[model samples]
Target: MPDNGDLRGVESTPRRDAQVRVFAMPPSDNATPTQIVQGFLEALTSDDPQYKTARMYLTPRAAENWQPERSTTVLADGPDAAARAPVQDDDEHVAFTLTGREVATVDAQQAFSPSSGEYNKLLRLIRDAETRQWRIDIVPQGVVMGQSDFERNYMSVNKFYFASNTAGATRNEPPMAVADPVYVRSHVDPTTQMVRSLLAGPTTWLDPVVRSSFPTGTALAKGAGSLTPDDRGRLVVPLNGKAAEVGTGRCEEMAAQLLFTVRSPTPAVEEVELRSGDKELCSLAQESAEAVATRGSLHSPEYLYFLDEDQRAVRIAAGSDDTEPEPVPGALGEGEKQLRSVAVAWDEHTAAGVAVDGKSLYVGSLVSGGSLGEPVLRSTGKTEADRLTAPSWDARGGLWVADRNPAAPRLLLLEEGAGEPMEVRTPGLDGRIQSVRVAADGVRIALVVEKGDRRSLLIGRIERSRPDGGTAERSPVTVLELRSAAPELEQVTAMSWTGDSRLVVVGREKGGVEQMRYVEVDGSTPDIQQPAALTGVKAVTASPDDKVPLVAYSVDGIVRLPSASQWQKITKGTAPVYPG
Candidate 1:
């Protein structure tokens, strides 16, 4: 794909969203004003790394002023610039107005935030006397393309960081790696770009809840051009002197952060080596990197649990279909209490259950001979409809639930699933919460708030503050800055944090059929990629390991949908759930 001289096609990263790769060609000789504008827009959508071809249609002054890396504004449809109005008195000047409907924007830090509005801008073109060719005299600062082009040109990747507030986090208990998702150019050097983004720190929205191990002023070495894996599958990164000052433990953490951030694109990389000048700071292998961040380090659940026909909690093998359902070895599973809904802990050693009346919340061990404890938290609502919703457990041994009492609605949290229930302050919440799902990272919590007749899904960041210089265990908690995660769904019936930054939601539009789809926490992009439709879906749950089958309680009773397979009714059960 190159001509005979020194010129050649640029190196490329694999395309994650599409199979075809599109290239942009330079402007033709003596192109018309409209053609110049159109050609430039086409170049913006191609795989040109730094947009060199796109700038060829711009004037020398405009080219230097344009900053394509500043941001990318995605529209519902590609911009229209065919209509041109010629300028009077200046025979060589003409202007075109670009118009489209804005959908979302990716900032310089690669954070995608959803937006909506009319997009309109004017571009003026002038014919150069020397070359007698038309070129754009004024250009927009950033790239603008349709949603389709945005997907084609970019891919999403999660940058790993440690949770800042979960103090007692361990490898298997509380998830340590917080996934800060960002968009990167699909055809660029994405691995190297991801490393730079990791060093730059988390995005504005996620910075308050997560922290990077890399110290301040730390950056890549002066000129480590185009990092790639060697034949032995080791990719070495050279960092600046600022990063070289960290100790051994922090250096390994930096390596783990780099390893996970680039794993999506460079899965073949067996090891990552960090260097400062010629000295090796530290080396970490992919096999043992989980010691630093434990998210996705463990296997999927071995059994799926639910309530059986007799209203007793039961369990079945997660990998087999012929296995008969049996009552679990816990108090909740012992037919001692009738449960209306349930939640299991991350380790599968404990579980929380809501009574049939939904006012009492109980915790019990799943081991044989273990007993059920008294109600950890209870609601005093008059009726079952106004009682507590299902309970949720955080990664750090914390249990969360919301009481929908019309008089004193509250979101309660228990440390280690015991002791006095602490009321978590919700600053921006204006409606009564009906559901609760805390992310494994423990930095985010999802709530279904009900106002009048509408139920909306909102994601809020959890902030832990020490007012009087208290210990790690005494950090006061608050859930503020709540943002809508599914603004289009008229009613979000149920949802779960299926992945790091993604949620599987069951919702409906205005007088439309109920649908199941996936939504990101930002609530900016539409959920075009979704799951198959299931009817009478009462609740849906997915494992933290995200690789397991989806289990839901619906009209078909308890059903499981394996990867690339149709949903099958495995047993006649209700309130099915995999351990959180």
Candidate 2:
């Protein structure tokens, strides 16, 4: 810790875009009104504790009323704090127009959402009667900055939630962990802020589908703010009395949520101890958290599956030696089904295969002597190109695929990879369906829609309507709120879900070379370094487990990129995949 109290608690992480540290400078001895505004804006972008330097430039009344923690407005470039004409009514007053193109906003709850619009805010500066110097008398609530500044100051972290498991007591199956990502200050007690965000409940978009284990009105114990792990990497969280009421099982669930939500905090946390009003409730180690819920969560140290040159399903041990790929034990692997692409279920017991002609979708088990059943789905498109896209499976036994018949494009969902197929409504979709991939959480789906020469990558939210006594004929499921995830790319060739809120995309910019990168589901580009560019990436697949290597199907055959390693040829196979 530093001698300066303000710098003591803050970590010394360099800015994302810069090599050197960038700290907020306090108002100068005799700063002008414009200087005060500019300095204040810059300070808002800094990781200063509660924007203390920014408050110094504001009038006492303004500073007292200002709330920088309420929300954050991010712009394309930055606010243009240009000096406007002076106020004619008062000689001591001057007005400035702070203008910028709004790109997105982070609400008080820390949920980041994409937005677009013209921004116009008025800031009034008044000459202080005592100091005879300019001070901002009026300002907007919350902070505002450029996107780049936001990226440098804030990082995205996921808050865990359990699926709306209404079947409470059966114990037949545990609810899965749902990841809800939000942005928080990079170094300003992120562990504490993440806990607060979790206590505040989920973001609006995810609120309906996910459930928090915390009791209603549950909050941190009074005055238990700014939590940090001790030298032993143990974090003790003191919660309100509401948390103490739960039993051992539920308390462990609450601790699991905390362990995951606070894992991003630096100086890593190994264990989390939950306490309520001076009494320790429960303690959970970080590794043990996943077992309580995410057992079938596409776990790591799993094999990578793909179709070889013979159009047979094969797999190689992920993150392992560069050995030759072997055939998977299944009818699709042994039988002469002649498949184009395939999707292995999360449990790895069943699989879905798209035929070589791309007109049929077949399903079967993955054990020895597992026989392929009749085609579960058969597209009627005249040509193979207009048939079914690659099959994708969700954690909740939902299989998704898009039919690009052109005449009647449809997004279909098969329940448990069996029975009658349900047509998933595409409400805000544009053009014909090109490809579809459902996320592991099953709350979001990624699609590549081709309207013309341009192929766009869009992210759609899954909404299961299921009205009372609804039948398969009714519009029970729909993919809504279609928004571009990669508007900068001209043509999207392929993509795969890399994690809870991130995707690995293979695409080319307008007239640019083909490249591979990652983009957040909120349509924001993360600050982490992207994978090295690969050429002719026809398809891509990534694991929910970060330790598993990223595999891709390219013109040069199948290749895998391990963490911090150069691309290595795994084998000559196409449509490489991990348990989805």
Candidate 3:
């Protein structure tokens, strides 16, 4: 057991690495109030580290106080709709307002969440009597970018952390790597920015579950402003005086963390060295880091489990080397009752299923001769839409389900046995949750929310706050920082977590055909091997490990993405899944 820290995950490849192109029309020598406001908004989408060009449109005082990191407002549409207000009592003063539906927001510390409502960016401009130039007099402290620009200008990067080595764990359960996604400038040297972000520590959402090997207040060694790999592809990160306190072994762990986080498909770093001033404290090669690294997840399930044409649960190994599909041993395999969807527990000892009628949920043992026990939960809604969509199990043995009943739509959590179910509170949610999948870490919840005609994929943070007495609470707590995880999809039909920070989704773009692709929990698409063509995909499931093959239930039958380029049929099945 290593005395390092809790594990974190990172995907082998980024979602997208396109260079960010900002079309900021250079400000004219003499700009008007409206032109200055428009130009400033455009510059917000650029990869400017210090908004120097943008500051030109604002007064000296306003520029001094303007903090681009204060917050990020995501507008639903482009900024062309900006409306200039009518003349006021003073001709020198003018105002412009940009109105659109707010989709999400990033706080000062870079926490992202889903948001809605009429979002307005108000800019009060005034004419400088002496300079004859108009400047922004009053404005918010953050930048506002349209959705298109948001996708184009920003990219998601995962900073790695280690898993907690618990007591009495099994031989197969070594500490693994975990990935926490953070957005950074796409055009910047990602190697440098990623290293800096890693040094800053994990984001708010990931702080509680994961731990970093770097000591508190640890930073790049003094005089080191950026990180770069040497001629031999070895990244040398200089730490400040704070690193001097770390011992040899601890410093090696820190080097391992850096080695894994900095290496990617591009910029392929071969080794990492931790330094204090001119002295090298610890170093790790990429191969050594992989010995204890998860890369993205801990489990790599071999068999893809699903329900057959007879609605009986069955299992099929993912690779082409496997034989025919085999029936699971539990009661579901016996087909006593019809089921709509099913989820296997992480230990593969139990299975949760929703009845064909979509009204009742059942739990049964996976061992041979195990019986499909009675329904553990039943929907109280009056219609079929109110029935359970699918079941998901967490590492802690908790089963999650969503009741889409219009009268009482809700997300519920049930203990392993007949424990009472608890309802999770979702604030600022404007639609009915169609499906839900809980991550292994037990902190983030992936949801397929249906609002009117649009079905969107959202990620919500599970908040479990203690009461005033500091006693543990039982009921499902609240969900905060709900944000769009797949904003580009026209409609998200089904999704499953492929890695700690990655999800494989079946969705279609506006006016496009339905397809399967990989997306980050932060709503950014990764550069994945495009899976083989899958049409009429009813459900898709993949092991959290990227090496594991992705299985899907399409109109034709059950198929798997053996390689990035193509999909092959294995057997006939529906609602495929893996042990959570």
TM-scores of the models, in the given order? 0.91, 0.90, 0.74
RMSD after CA superposition, every candidate: 6.3, 5.8, 9.1
lDDT of 3 at 560: 77
Residues 281-372 of candidate 1: C-alpha lDDT, one tens digit per residue: 99999988876557733447778888988777898887567437998887888888899988888878888899999889999988888777
> Which lDDT tens digits does candidate 2 get at residues 1-580?
4466453364686654543346799888767777888988999988786888889889999999999999999999989987687445345888898999999999988878778888889898888888887889889999999988988788899888876732322555656777888999985778888898899999887787778889999999999978989998899999988888898888888888888788865537999999998788999997787666662234673688899888999888878876598888988889559999999888788889999999999998888887886899999999999999999998777788889998888999998899889888888788887888887777778899999899999988787765647554543787787888888889999998876678999999998989999998877787777997788889889887766778898888998898887877777888988887
- Please tell me which predicted candidate would have the highest lDDT against the true structure: 1
Worst 10 residues of 2 by lDDT: 165-174
lDDT assessment of candidate 2: 0.84
lDDT winner, 2 or 3: 2
Candidate 1 lDDT (Cα, 0 to 1): 0.85
Q: Residue 12 in candidate 3 has what lDDT? A: 89
Instruction: Indicate which candidate wins on TM-score.
Output: 1
Steric clash pairs (candidate 2): none
> Number of clashes in every candidate structure?
1, 0, 22
